[model samples]
Target chain A: MLKKVHCVRLDGDKAELEDEIAEEVPLVIFVNGKHFSTAMISPQMREEFVTGHLFTEGIIDGPVDIESLKVESNTAKVLTRHSTTFLESRKVILSGCGSTSSFLDKKKLPKICSNLMLDRTMVLNAMKAVLRSDNFKRSGGFHSCGLFNESGAIIVVDDIGRHNALDKVIGFGLIRNLDLKDTFIATTGRISSDVALKCARANIPVIASKGAVTTLAVEIAENSGLTTAGFVRGNKMNIYSGGRIN
Target chain B: MLKKVHCVRLDGDKAELEDEIAEEVPLVIFVNGKHFSTAMISPQMREEFVTGHLFTEGIIDGPVDIESLKVESNTAKVLTRHSTTFLESRKVILSGCGSTSSFLDKKKLPKICSNLMLDRTMVLNAMKAVLRSDNFKRSGGFHSCGLFNESGAIIVVDDIGRHNALDKVIGFGLIRNLDLKDTFIATTGRISSDVALKCARANIPVIASKGAVTTLAVEIAENSGLTTAGFVRGNKMNIYSGGRIN
Candidate 1:
């Protein structure tokens, strides 16, 4: 999603120009005829983001929990086979990259168990493939995520938020009944604790990125038995946990 | 804040190394002894972030609206003169950079009115000053925000979240009774609509960044009568709204 806008370019002298900017929309999620959460994301991949977000948020166990889901414009209506008790007690307003509700508690997190391993070439290639997103290259404002196995990159998605991109990727895999434990994710955003938590909740084996990682993210990944690789640039990368790279 | 962690660096061969990652902590806000919201932020500048956040969220008009504020370990206790009715009706779980509650509505936003002007050198210097944060330079995971006037940078703060950094900067100005309308902000993160709304609400005249801008952000900036400069590089930048740069 790119939007053209008129702007003034300033160099040694001012020059008028038109530039492309990434579009962000507010997607409100309604669960069982009630408001659940709102996420700011790119216009593409709305359904995938909703499914992945619900699963990662622990609102749903899997895709089967969702009876029906419809996304019209900026609103997503989801009918799930669960009570609304979880929604009543846990209404939190999370600003920025912070989610300080039940998910932040380490004891409540799910432990990832998998035997997935990747070679140096595979890790580097995945990072490259994700970084080569057309939306990011065009607008320079979108974060990208890619799901990969030993074969190659399977599904790649971009969103205004890095968390949304990863959630969309996971949702795509869940709908297709893919073995998430056998797949890894490559992202173009920093591996914060929340990002690491999403990967752990999704049961993804490895989370690789061409960005930096936070201290809490490393601790959570180490505790959850998930591998984290950051700074995956040309010919170099850092493995924070789950030394599953050969 | 940086934490030393043992990690494996993979180039052609894997080598063990010690790396520094940024630290993130959950700061739970309690208004009138009641839980308000929780934010994930860097450990430093808790008080400034709290004050700025309350003002930007429209919970308080200024620093005087707060009777007392105390920040302990990870909890910030704020006693406001206003009733908690606003908190009861508006509880939203914003997953990423989305705040679809009261703040996202453009009609409810405060239009910025200021005569602040900056030269090309001033704009470029502010961007450079903000980007030269030691925390970001060391860990490569912290987002930085700087308050600037025509002379130079005033206050610079770094946080795990960009929104937190800006809020800390605003709080610093508020506590010092600085005229926010006469100053501007420079950040090291993408300019999103929520960020632009924060500046508009705070009456900050200009927002410049070395990162990209979203389409919604540009629209909000234009509507709020604020100036937005993006891609502030060596000798060039793009002006999206309120052409206040000479």
Candidate 2:
């Protein structure tokens, strides 16, 4: 995947730099030999995306349920097989593009838990620390997603796609066997349905994005009991739903 | 939708000025009483996004088969109670996060006529012209997409969302009854499958963007008879496929 990266940064007209590296990656997914989708993502997280996308999309539930997940780095093929009726109903197919967006099942948003409390100082302090973890400051492109426990320290995953970043966190959580309850998914990208859905899929209760939030995302959070906050910079933030700041 | 907008222009750590105005005009889609997707886009040409999304995604054939295409200001929604099969298999969705990305059906790309003649230089020049069309210089955040004929002038759309911008151009083209063939779509974002599908959806043979192209997008264009190019900034570009430079 690094071999396919064509780095051509222009200074005036000519290429300031044109090099091949494993940077921008294209992953094509096949489900049951059917072309599921092709995504341009960081090659590092193919399996994570597979398990995360399949699980979060409600395609399948857990790693054990996934029959197998394979990635061919050169061809960029991510083959995923499932062992459940998760792909049942054959109801909706949406071509969701971006680091984070609302994909589907808006009605399934998690019920907001009532006992959680967010300390403004903790959240703000985390922002300053999160900025240091940005891979974008090094690569010039990429979105970062973080997961924090009740104490709000940055558990970071930086990737070219914000969704990938979230998946990395989810995967990390899975690996560490951390509980998702009362946790929050924080990202540098906009809080859309896709982002909210992933949090709901993980059963995380609160989401905070340093960017904007779509109307549908707000509606999904409001209706489903998931707490959402956007433009969450400094001491002030817009509470789109779930009533903490409100 | 305007109520969902929060504006802030910062020289540093301050909200300096804030107001809800119709600044980021682009495209958004709704399906069956739910907000499906929205992209920051040019307001003028939205119907095409509404139509092109359907076509490239294999949703519908022509505009007449659809029920209604409507746009008020920056919001565009195309609705159809089509053959139920198309609706049911439509769970996987693509919503561009105001950023051009690759998240589409690569294995099922549109087949072009194969006899189409694409003039590369003309499209590249149009790409340069597109840079000046952005209101992003004012808003500081937005992407633009345009469709141009052989003459090199284009109908351009700018938005915070690259998908919306492209959709606006498509929408505008449909309303004007414009023929997409011998024309090209130029964008200030990446040349990804979703964006490439915009041209393929319009049956346009060429697409040029002032950014990178995903490997899958290049593959789709090469096979779809759609010529693709990327990184067009002031007299330079790399031809990804399907056109003669002369």
Candidate 3:
């Protein structure tokens, strides 16, 4: 996940330094033997990312919808039980942080109905734990996400893209048959509308971030009945919507 | 570019606080009367973003390739001198931070050829100038990019997406008929492979960022002859590729 490279450091004095950088690889997904999309990822957790990405993008209802998933090199071949007509019709390439092809209709999103409530200390600890990764600390180029409950973090993933990280965590939960509604997510990325929408689509109740929350994200969380929290650092956090925090 | 919202601030004592957040809107692009893509942007500099995006995505060679560009609300209607066959044939949704449709063939990318050299002071100053944005400070959700020469920052743009911010600055330079080969870009986001490719596509010789650089980004910069610098914090920087800095 990390590659060492020689760099010239300019800090009052010129010094040659070796730095570790995160690796980014293009992961191509094919559905029903047709090309779907290609994502530049951190090259780990390919199956989880593919599974979570398909679910979050609304391509598949759940993991059971996939008959088989095979990852060869950088390509993921997914054979689903459903037809490919839905994929062909909705080819709209939607862009946010990078470019996603998911067409997000706010009204169509399912409102979260989980009764999961988190305390201030738990949220802060989750944020801290999710961010505690050797890859991120070494490379400083990865965004991290984790699924957590009152006990601790269940699965933590680090990716070059925050969206991919969250998707990987969601996929992990789906594969493990974990109750996603009873869990919350903590991330190192901003709580954008897309991020909030992903949690809603996955039926995750709460999302806390170590960054700021966008206004559209706040609105979507409010309408979707999802709890959104941001700035989870040093015992301080701002709750944007769905006051389920204790 | 910003919106005010009510939130619950959680420190030691819970208090109701009014906060400002960055606005994200979907900007749909239509090329030659065909639906191209939709980008979630910060709702500013729509025209510049369109121009820069087209060029960076290799949709148009330059600003002259576009016959007419019209923006209504969030939709960008572009009439190009070229045929839409290129768009139809290459419908691959390439995802990095989000989803982009550009098929990036590293061998096909144009090698940047420029004699632009920068002193340490100038590069550091440019990074500082570009990051000095009121929107980012207020909303804390903006990724900023700037086009700079020895004189200082020519144009600085802030968006929810770093790719959009860089594209906006590139578009600004394209419209003004500026010599992009002589200028560089400064960004507050990480220097990923897509970003390095964007600068190379725009014929920009250098890109400096106050963040980390991916390994693929370093390879792309080195191969394309583009100067890539990262970790441009106070009084320090790391030169990853193209040693054009004194």
lDDT of each: 0.85, 0.59, 0.84
Q: What TM-score number comes out for model 3?
A: 0.93
Candidate 1 C-alpha lDDT tens digits along B139-199: 8888999999988999899899998999999999998999999999999988988799889
* Order of candidate numbers by lDDT, starting with the best: 1, 3, 2
Give per-residue CA lDDT, model 2, range B1-246, as digits (tens). 233343333223435244332232324455444454455433444566677666545556667667876765545556676752333224334432222243334455666663556455676668777887636443323576778877776677666566667666765666566776756788877665556666776788877777666655665677677777666777676666675343
Query: For each candidate, what TM-score against the reference?
Result: 0.93, 0.65, 0.93
CA-based DockQ, model 1: 0.51
Docking class of 2: incorrect
Worst 10-residue lDDT window for candidate 1 chain A reads: A88-97
Tens-place lDDT per residue, model 1, A129-228, is: 9988998898889999999999999999988899999999999999999999999999999998879888988899899988898887887888788899
Off by over 4 Å in 1: A87-106, B86-106
lDDT of 2 by residue, A7-94 (tens): 3332334343443221455556556565555556766756766666666666665565656566665232333353334232222333
Judged by TM-score relative to the true structure, which candidate is superior, 2 or 3?
Answer: 3
In the order shown, the candidates' Cα RMSDs to the true structure are: 3.7, 7.7, 4.0
